[model samples]
Target chain A: MKTLVWVEHDNSAMADATLAAVTAAGKLGEVHLLVAGSGCRAVAEQAAQIAGVGKVHLADNAAYANALAENVAPLVVDLMSHHDAFVAPATSHGKNITPRVAALLDVMQISDILSVEGEKTFTRPTYAGNAIATVESTDAKLVITVRGTAFDKAETTGGSATIEDVSGAGDAGLSSFVGAEIAKNERPELTSAKIIVSGGRALKDSETFQQVIMPLADKLGAGVGASRAAVDAGYVPNDYQVGQTGKIVAPEVYIAIGISGAIQHLAGMKDSKTIIAINKDEDAPIFQVADIGLVGDLFKIVPELTEKL
Target chain B: MKALVPVKRVIDYNVKPRVKADGTGVDLANVKMSMNPFDEIAVEEAIRLKESGAVTEIIAISVGPAKAQETLRTALAMGADSAILVETDDEVEPLAVAKILKAAAAEVQPGLIILGKQAIDDDSNQTGQMLAALMNLPQGTFASKVVVEGDSVTVTREVDGGLETVKLSLPAIVTTDLRLNEPRYASLPNIMKAKKKPLDVKTPADYGVDITPRIKTLKVAEPPVRQAGIKVADVDELVAKLKNMGVA
Candidate 1:
């Protein structure tokens, strides 16, 4: 079986999520990476080095500069004739584009698979991680999105894959990119961060959420996350949210401060390797899953912990 | 311009779903059902557009069991002008749902089609995009903000890193994200008024679409349970435990 994995990148370096997706694709069959972007020969070179990649298909065109689904989905669907399955990291770009490819291919897509059970079956979370469903696809050509946290990252180097330039499936002329307001942060991206410091509504407001969570996150060299309550309360931007409806992170060490740990919130972070909760409420649900629970005031405890660390 | 907003009736967001012992599926015999929260945001956004005078009418639609009419009534109560219920008993996957919506859009000829990014039950996050694909329309998924001008719509999307703004020609598809807007609750009088609104019932056969399940569920089970660990006495002890575990 030949599997084509879409490489997520910024026209230069490949996103870490793609490496994890490569690992998932390796389990299915020989992996071929598709680097579809403008001026992205650097990204294609990077994709060619990941371990287990057999070939890298490069589609360099101005129409793909923004990775718009209208433009990229046709490109992927056009290439589906040569492959059996299509795999992509379940990032925003992947989620936005893969379904279009699936619809065009007249196939059902399996979204956010946690494990590859067999050639056609997989396990995925349902009802916001409250239940796990094992589903087997009957589609002749499979399209799948892999959750990065579920698989270990493939080695970045030590592979020599042949690069083949593929023609771009020209612009679809449906949508056009206007502008983007991407937050510039020095901290690691939340999904790829090894450690995460998450705050909750109890942080009071945006000012306090930052003052308390930022120092500790910087101390631990971790990504900053917020419970849905915090994001809803205007304590932080929506991008900082970490929950079922928000970004899902499974870091090595997760520190929850002032988080009440709703089922939706736990759905995102319960998979972390180690959880530490510090909330004044002794009976908060977060403590149930926390590897280490500290019952106290977060305002004081968080600062003190940051100081000590 | 007419706006079509798709709503779904799923298990309430607050209710924790329990997998059946026989591993068939989630037990929903007597579960509390409500409109999917994301769809509520979509409905709210459409109402806001109508209030702003950009949308002349708002029509809500849903494809589910007959009980889904209650979900549409809720949308009507919230401010939709009318509704359509594509009644079905079989589980409709995203592709089929998109196809049904595409057929419905042809009959309705709405200027905008807005829906939830994903339903809470399946969480597939595919319908709106697939609908856009089948209909050959522009799509804006995970929309946090939407602005409709004369012949175009601008949508601000909630992407992984931050926000991305895109411009699409009118008669486009926009899916709601969490940060879109807080949905409004229906007042008692509005609930009564919703009963008098127009509701058209149709089926998959009416749209010439086959609503069959392409995926077979072998089993459904609970996620792995996480065991709670010991509570530390103070911050000092917490730091010491982390060091011992080599977490820092």
Candidate 2:
């Protein structure tokens, strides 16, 4: 089976999630990486070094600079004639593009598979991770999005692969880029962070949430996360949200301050290696999954814990 | 110009789904069903656009069981002008649903199509993008804010890193995210009036589309349970435990 993995990059550097996706694609058979962007030769070069990749298909074009699904899906569909399966990371970018590819190819796209059970079968979480479903595809070709946290990252070095220049499906002229407001943070990215400090609605306003959550996150060199309630209440940016609908993080250590652990919130971070919950409510559902439960007022405990750390 | 919004009937967001004993799938018997939350936002956005005079009419659509009419009525109560239900009993996958919606869009001829980013049941965030691809139209997905100007629309999308703004020509697709708008409850008068609104029921065959299962379910099971751990007495103890774990 020949598999094509879309390399996730920011035009200059490849994302860690792509390495994890490469690991998932390695299970199918020979892995080929597709790097499509303007001036993204460095990304293709980076993709060529992954341990098991056999070939890197580079589509360097000005049209793909924004990575619009309109242009990228046609390129992927054209490539699907040679490949048996296409795999991508379950990031926002991947989610936006893979379905379009599947629809164009007239195949069903499986979103966010956690495990590759066989050549045709895979397991994925549904109903906010409360249930897992194993599904097998009958389609001639398969399109999948891999949950990066569920797979190990492929070795960044060792094996060599060939990079081939492929022409892009230039400018579909469907959507135009306007502007972006990405948060500039010095801390780690949430999905790849080793430690995460998450706030909940109990943090009150945005001011208090930052005052309490940021210092602790900084002290631990951790990523900042927030419950959906906190994000909906305007305590943080939408990117800081960690829940079923938000970013999923399986950090080495996850600290939940003043979080009551709604099922949706737990769905995102319950896989953390060690979970610590500090809440005034003794019976908060978060305590059930927390490895270390601290029943106290976070206003006092979080600051004190930050100082002690 | 008219706006087309597609809603879905799914297990309510707050309900905890249970895997059946035989592991076929999640048990939906006696479960409270509602319009997918994101679709509620889509309907709300459409209604708001109508109120703002950007949209002349709002047409809500759903592809599900006959009971989906109830979901459509909810959209009507929320102020949609009319609704269509492509009734089906079989589980419709995203690609097929997109095809059905493509046919519906052809018949409705709306200037804008809005849908939920994903239904909470299957959690497959694909329908809107797939429909866009099938129709060869531009897509602004996971939209937090949408502004419709004459022949184009500017949408603010909730992407992984942060917000991205994109402009799409008329007859584009936009999927709702959480921050789009807070859906309002249908007042009693609206509920009473919604029953009188026009609801057209049809099937996939009417659109010359085939709705078949392309994926076979091997099993349905519960996720691994996380065991509760020890409780620390104080902040010092918590800090000590973290040090021992080499995390801090």
DockQ of each: 0.86, 0.90
For residue A14, give model 1's deviation from the true position in Å: 0.5
Model 1, residue A129: distance off in Å is: 0.6
Q: What tens digits encode model 2's per-residue C-alpha lDDT throughout B1-248?
A: 99999999999988989999999999999999999999999999999999999999999999999999999999999999999999999999999999999999998999999999999999999999999999999999999999999899999999989999989998999999999999999999999999999999999999999888899998999999999999999999998999999966
lDDT (10s digit) by residue, model 2, range A1-309: 999999999899999999888988999888999999999999999889999999999999988987889989999999989999999999989999999999999999999999999998999999999999999999999999999899999999996999999996688988888989989989999999999999999999999998999999999899999999999999999999998999999999999999999999999999999999999999999999999999999999999998999
Best by lDDT: 2
Candidate 1: tens digits of C-alpha lDDT, residues B1-248 = 99999999999998989999999999999999999999999999999999999999999999999999999999999999999999998899999999999999999999999999999999899999899889889899999999998899999999988999999998999999988999999999999999999999999999999988899999999999999998999999998988897766
In the range A1-309, model 1's lDDT, one tens digit per residue, is 899999999898899999989999999999999999999999999889998899999999998988999999999988899999999999999999999889999899999999999999999989999999999999899999999899999999999899999996668888899988889999999999999999999999999998999999998899999999998899988899998889889999999999999999999999999999999999999999999999998888999999988
Candidate 1 chain B weakest ten by summed lDDT: B239-248
lDDT of 1 at A133: 96
Residue runs of model 1 more than 4 Å from their true location after superposition: none
Of the true interface contacts, each candidate retains a share of 0.84, 0.92
- Report, to 2 decimal places, the DockQ of model 2: 0.90
Please compute the TM-score of chain B alone for each predicted structure, in the order given.
0.99, 0.99
Interface RMSD of the candidates, in order? 0.8, 0.7
Give the alpha-carbon lDDT of every model. Answer: 0.94, 0.94
